[model samples]
Target: MTKTYQIQSYFNFLKRSTNQHGVHSPFVYDLVTKCFYDKKKYPAYQNIKAYRQHLLSNTTTLEITDLGSGSQVFKTTKRSISKMASVAGSNYNDAKLLYRLTHYLQCDSILELGTSLGIATQALALGRPKAALTTIEGCPNISAAAKASFKKFDLKYIDVVTNDFSEAINGLKTNHYDLVYFDGNHQKEATLQYFETLLPTITNDTVFIFDDIYWSKDMTAAWNIIKQHPKVTVTIDTYKFGFVFFRQEQAKEHFTIRL
Candidate 1:
């Protein structure tokens, strides 16, 4: 999880990545141009921005529980909200992109695997405020803090669950999600396990976003294997995030996009 290394890797990705002009598929082209590269200023961005500011200004501290691969930036169990906001939170652009993608997809049922400080979750919530959204967090204190933030931001519509990702996701057997955000566990096997478990819940229009695909070699291998899965008809690797789509009508294709 070295930023310098990740920054160096971006050059290699840039060489391999393309823009809307290079995208042949109609769906992908529209996504790349209209959603991914969209320059429109969304009104919901104000809420997202305000939420982030609060996180940065907040001095409250919480005792964290590491359920997956432990934090690389944080060494101790106790950390300040501002510290997490600065170190663990989604980048501002990424937060905006998540909102845009949610708006673009118009997915009514959304599930988020990791809540952390709920920065990304807040973006997703603002993306489609009315959608039945559920986010899971392994740490109880973190979940409580996120829940409070949702209330502060008037995003009471989001349902925050405090539980391990595996346990929470397994209990949702009957529920199907139109969009799923995978950000909780970065380890390889756990990521794969989550993918398999949720595979049955996806529809032809479902969209899955996997964060930090290049966090480790194990994660890169996981991304490659996920691309080869039969049901995953389309995949877009932006280096930072891997976007998966399951459209039976489309041919299996993978793209590396410069984002």
Candidate 2:
């Protein structure tokens, strides 16, 4: 059922998705042409790929504890580190896009909701080494494993917090982030709750990126609700990811761009 839903959702995305040519907004056009469509082979990309590869080569197994919309790919609590890195972490394309996005946006501070294997977090940090990044993982063991991976790669400018996202966000209210990447809870209610709670932390140029927006019906509906929110000025749905911008200077527009 999940696979079928994703197929249908992807087809819908293809029908609605456009290229930079279709975008009239200068902000979006620049992002599409300069960032999303960029083909440069950045040096940080080497580190990003190596980070995931390092995790993939590890065979260490750990007892798992899922705190969000449970895994779509795993069936057991006992899983190998390599299996998690192979099946659960962000893929090369998405991670590389994240690297480009971090550089393109010149994000000075970033927040990541889920740090599963720290695949995305690695990309975020390597993309902008100077940016202060805080990544929260719900499960202690998983967080520990990811933190270990970070240290192995000698990646800096990261703060890992092991706690439920609700508690984690409570302590971050006074901080403003250039970007927030939501890869934590995929359910509708939790996603919405987090969105509302994080609303106060966004500046006009802040961007929010959501992973697996088409992974489930409820998630897609949550994306719709987020799109219509009063604070959102621009949004881009890339099938694998959804980008939300809170630029008050721009007109409200939703773009579906194939990445």
Scored by lDDT, the top model is 2
Model 1 lDDT tens row, 1-259:
4566677677888989888888999999999999999998888888888999999999998898989888879999999999999999898999999999889999799999999999999999888889999999999999999998988888967989999898888988678899999998999999999999998889999999999998877888899999999889999999989999999999999999988
Point out where model 2 deviates above 4 Å. none
Measured with C-alpha atoms, the lDDT of residue 72 in candidate 2 is: 84
lDDT of each: 0.91, 0.92
Number of clashing residue pairs in every model? Answer: 0, 0
Q: Per-residue alpha-carbon lDDT of model 2 for 146-220, expressed as tens digits?
A: 989889888878999999999999889889999999998999999999999999999988999999999899999
Model 1 bad stretches (over 4 Å): 1-8
TM for candidate 1 is 0.97
